[model samples]
Target: MLTPYLAMFLDGRGLNSVEIGQLLALITLTRILGPNLWANLADRSGKSLRILQIGAALALASFFVIFIADGFWGLTLCFGLIMMFWTAIMPQMEVITLNSVAGDAHKYSRIRLWGSLGFILLTISAGRLIDWFGTEVLLVICLALLAALLLVSTRLREPEQLPDNSPHTGSIWSKLKSPVFLGFILALCLLQVGFGPYNSFFTLFMKDLGYSGMQTGLLLSLGVLAEILIFLKAGRLIQRFGIKWMLLISLALTVVRWALLAHFAHLPWVLIATQCIHAASFGLTHATAIQFIHRYFGRRYQSRGQALYVSLAGGLGGAVGNFGAGLLWQQGQGATQAFLAAAMVVGVSLVVILLIPSRHLECASEPAR
Candidate 1:
């Protein structure tokens, strides 16, 4: 709901395209700062569910103030507070979910597809709601969802503590210091940087292309539909091609997806094809990343590992992507250039992913459970 519509919503609130992009950059920046804070707390306390519930409750409280925020500063401050708390929820949640499934990639994908389903349903209906009522409805919808998150968090029980007896029991810094892990984090950060333009502007870009709110939502939904399917097959794909190869494939497809969108977005059919590859671009890439990180870090440091991914990859990379996309966008006139830049960044990440040392590969040969 937030990703596809926030640009449109801020536009309705009288913000310019560039301002909207900057606001998004700030929001993503919170992902960098917020998660690290919560991750440390959760790791120390050993209560991931409690951290998530607190984050959700705070995020909802902060977002409610959006109703009274009047100008750029007000809007920025309001959203910053909301996202600061909101970004903290997911990393902890990922740790909990992976623990529940015993790190089974296939089972994890099955559970995660429900989120994609929610994205599809909400994106489809939000567009219709916007077409009928207006973008202000975004606030109400977001508030309600945040409330639901808080409620759900309260209901969830943390997985039972398991004895982590694996050999590598060094400090968190030792795990962070590994060359392969560094490469993985850097590559993910760059890939996310590449994602900046599409994520921050695709909805607005669709509008500029003369697509209706409903069509824009459908286009976004179509990408997620593909994402859901990829997620369903994630385990098999990992078992067949292995995680390393699948990472490269996802990045290469993303490069193609963006380049095609840059040149052929006006071609509605081309748009559909690009959206279809979102499965590879986002779904597969994310699934593999989660599995890789789960296997890479020891159980004691799981929350921290997930937090670092969100903070560095999603937060830092997203900040650059959102901000740079704003500048390249030049108020929609430079959409093509913005997208091409994104493609090039992802291409760089493709090379970076190759830096993963062969010694640490878990799924390169053996079948994933």
Candidate 2:
């Protein structure tokens, strides 16, 4: 919801593409340290739920400051503070969610699918609302959602029993040193780098093509709706195809998706079709990656492993992508080039995915019933 409108909000404030990209990059930059810092504290204290609640509270407070922020630096500082806490929320929640479901990692998709639903709901409504009211409504809606998140956070309880019998048998460092794990992280980073253009500017791209805010929102929602469908069936797909093939397929689709967006964005149907690829590009890949992280890092290092994943793949990777996309985007012909460059980046990710050992791609173990 907030995501699909954030770039637009920045634009409405008279910021240029470069400034908006810089602000987005700054948000990702903090993810490099914020998640790890919070996760370490949570892991040491065995208080993930409490940590998440604190982060949520801080995030809400920091975001409210955005209402008063003026000028580039002020908005940047406020958004940065908001993201510092915001990034802390997801990785810790991933740990808690995985723990609560026990060994059935597949069940994660079912639980997480609700998030996709919420995103779709908010995104579509926000788009229409912005169309009716104005971009200023973004702040109010964001505040409302964050407040709801804060309220929800208070109700979440920590998982009582953590998973045992994780397949990996080495220290976190040793596992990180493994070729498969290293390759996987590298692939994830490249994939995120590819996502930079789409995440930062896709809505703007639609707007440039003369699409309304509601249209842009619907398109974005369409992608997540596809993602939700994939989530419902992700477990069975993983069982059949294995994580390696799933990732390979996703990366391959991402390349095509970006290419389509670059060359055929003027065609409404073409745009709609391309958006559906989000099912594989994000939905399957994310679910598979989470399970892989669980398997690779095991229980002892779960929180930190999730932190590192968010930091490297989502943080550094996204920062590079956003920064590069900003540099590439021009008044005209720039969006095309930016998206093409994105496709090329994900192409590299595909190669990295192929480099992982075949055995590593297979399911490590059946989910405990």
Candidate 3:
């Protein structure tokens, strides 16, 4: 719902590509700052759920202001505040989930699959709603969901801390300075930068190539569907291939996938086919990274470790990529050229993965229940 309306919202305001890109960059850059700040508090208080409820409430309230705000500055202010609150939700949720799964992290797939399922259901329903009622409906529905989530979130209890196995840690900055950890962060940052344009403008790209809105939703669904399958079996794949290998494979596949879409988005089937690679490009990479950090970082620093990773990779990388893609998309160099640029970034990321030290790896089985 948010995906489709994002470009339209800016377009509705008559903002140029550069302004749109900067707004998105500003929005996502909060991801970098928000997570680390909240992550530290969560660790100190061991109150992930409390952080989530508060953040969600703030986010919900902030976004409601968006429906009434007009003009660029007003929208930007509200949106930035909303993003600051919103960005805090996912990293903490992830930490909560990690705590819930305890030692048998492999089973994360079973639970995480519901998120993908929700996206599919919501994407289809939201698409239909937009088709019938228009994009404003999307914002209204988003506001409603956020409000409902804020209410329901209070019921979630924080998981009891398990016997933490992670190493004792210093400051977040020192951990980040480790060569291997630094390498992984850099790789993920580059990887997301490559993805920024696709996430920001893929629908427009499809429409430009003459695909209809319904087809665009279906194609996006295909990517999620592929992700569902991978989540179901990602543990087995990770055990077989290891995190480093999985990371390499995902980056390689992303390079191929983005390159194909860049040049061949005109063919609906071809784009659909390329979408299947999301399983590796997104699903595998995500699962592997989380597990990898769990194994490498000490239990005490889990939140900090995850936040650091997300801040650099998801926050910084995503911001740069979003802005760059916006500029490229606006330049009218066409989707093909923009996608090719993304592919090249992923290619560089693959090399970075290859350089990470093998000594940091330590896979331990969860004790039998």
Off by over 4 Å in 1: 361-369
Once fitted onto the true fold, the runs of candidate 2 whose alpha carbons sit more than 4 angstroms away are 363-369
Could you arrange the candidates by lDDT from highest to lowest? 1, 2, 3
- Report the lDDT tens digits of candidate 3 across residue range 245-334: 788889999999998987777776778778899999998898888876665665677777777778888889989998988888873455
1 or 3: which has the higher lDDT? 1
**Each prediction's whole-model lDDT (CA):** 0.86, 0.86, 0.78
**lDDT at 273, model 2:** 90
Error of 3 at 308 (Å): 1.4
**Residues 1-369 of candidate 1: C-alpha lDDT, one tens digit per residue:** 677788888888998878887888987888888888999998899999999999998898888799989788899888888888987799987899988988888899999999999999999999988999999998889989998989878889989877674455578898898777888888899999998888888888988999888999899999999999999999789877787789889999999999998898899899999999999989998999888877767678888889889999999999889989988887799999999999999999998877675546553234233
The clash count of every prediction, one per candidate, is 0, 0, 3
Would you list the clashing residue pairs of candidate 3? 166-298, 166-299, 167-298
TM-score, one value per model? 0.96, 0.96, 0.94
**RMSD of candidate 3 to true structure, Å:** 2.3
